[model samples]
Target: MTSTEAPLRYTAFTSDPEGGNPAGVVLDASGLDDAAMRAIAAGLGYSETAFVTRRDEAARRFRVRYFSPLAEVAFCGHATIALSVALAERLGAGDLLLDTSVGEIPVATGRDGSGAVVATLTSVPAHSRPAGRDELAATLSALRWRAADLDPALPPHVAFGGNDHLVLAAASRERLADLAYDFDALAAVMREHGWTTVNLVWRESPERFHARNPFPVGGVVEDPATGAAAAALGGYLRALGLVVRPTTIAIRQGEDMGRPSDLLLDVSPADDRVRVTGRAVPIAQAGA
Candidate 1:
């Protein structure tokens, strides 16, 4: 492709044009610099974008970078899914290694029973720690959520997979549904703590959850689908001994906002990492 040809990209996690988190996919970005990449991602105006440059075709490993419209991100799950499918279309489906800025992510791709290409990525290690009372209170204040709305059982904490996320479990679905926060206040707190997103979740069942992610650091109000936070939630559940290992949990996100998305996470007893899987569809190019 020539430089004049706008980068060939796609969005993942939603089949419909209007649904899911939109991601920019550049299957080949060998010649692009950081400025060029950031510009491209900004031009696309997606939440996050993936730039892939093959490092070793034989090994099926590629160096990847993630960028939001405004800046670079440590890792992005939906973009990873989109890149894997884009690669599969050209290189055939199987396993591929993505050497990201955070760490190496192993992704497996295959056609499901319905013939849709499904991709699963194993996150870098997972861990969670207590969120100080002061921090939690400050976050709640920024979110305009009262302490009574918090779930006592789940509590508040910071979880990490590839990046750090502050997790807040709501006492009711209604509380989680009404999301309005001081964007600048939350962004300040998140920046000070090096947090990528504030993962707000409400447990619907033992195996099901409703989630919303406030990504102020990325200059977005909310992320429709967040894979990294999903992995972190899996780790949080395991750390709290809330769920059985080797079990899968379904996360229903973006529904309240109208762009519904499904994220499946697999947790295992033997390892601390979590696996997130989903289907990604390419967004058709808009007529210029």
Candidate 2:
């Protein structure tokens, strides 16, 4: 509590402590430099950790930074949710405006029907473009997946929320479940294209889907729940006219990994921004 020592750990996108992506939260990182934050994030070994550099209690505004094990990231969705839930526990549920490297993100925290704190984040302007032939081929090769394995309906696209993500839809659930890929090759492709994660998904229904994210760039083999990618997906779907009308989709991630996270996305053609909602829970310290 004194100038941010060890970070407070929390899991996002799920109610269970053990069933979501875990992130470290440094509530007051006022004095810590970049090196210190990077070192703390690397030591914790999470996909991403959030540091609150400045806070305006009266305004409910905060400036934050995110770091993965390898380096600082522009933005991170799960960490944002985790941090918001953590703050809500202390400040009570309401609205918060976060100043991040990408842009200002508006987040609202409230209790769900079960009385569990849930955080909903509105992403910045979102958009997407079709992945080029060479880019698609390289990504498919790196994933060891053939072009035939892709779903024709969801063409390959590079989508953006706060960050960029490669969205690929699998033809079947089996293809989505089998996720072994060449780490070095995929990482190279991602770096070349500036993709944060490869969002591999399978459509179960009009409003439900399963997703898995390969995040080699962040030095993680996989991400259980990715909020930024989810927002990007909403943009992708809407931009491509996949969702003809306003609707909400349920994205089930990390089920294969046994973490089992749930993310809800509200997408409307009238607006470009995506609303992603999820619940976060604090992780008890070891032997606490």
Winning candidate number (TM-score): 2
lDDT tens readout by residue for model 1, 88-162: 877889999999988999999999887778899999999888899888988999999999999999978899989
TM-score against native, each model? 0.96, 0.98
Model 2 residue 250 CA deviation (Å) reads 0.4
RMSD of each candidate? 1.4, 0.8
Highest lDDT: which candidate? 2
- Residue 99 Cα positional deviation in candidate 1, in Å, after optimal superposition: 0.3
TM-score of 2: 0.98
Q: All candidates' lDDT scores?
A: 0.87, 0.95
- Model 2: per-residue lDDT, tens digit, 1-288? 645567999999999998999999999999999999999999999999999999998899999999999989999999999999999988999999999999999999999888889999999999999999999999999999999999998899999999999999999999999989999999999999899999999999989999999999999999999999999999999998878888999999999998999999999999999999999998999787
Candidate 1 Cα lDDT to native: 0.87
Give the TM-score (vs. native) of candidate 1: 0.96
- Model 1 CA deviation exceeding 4 Å by range: 1-4
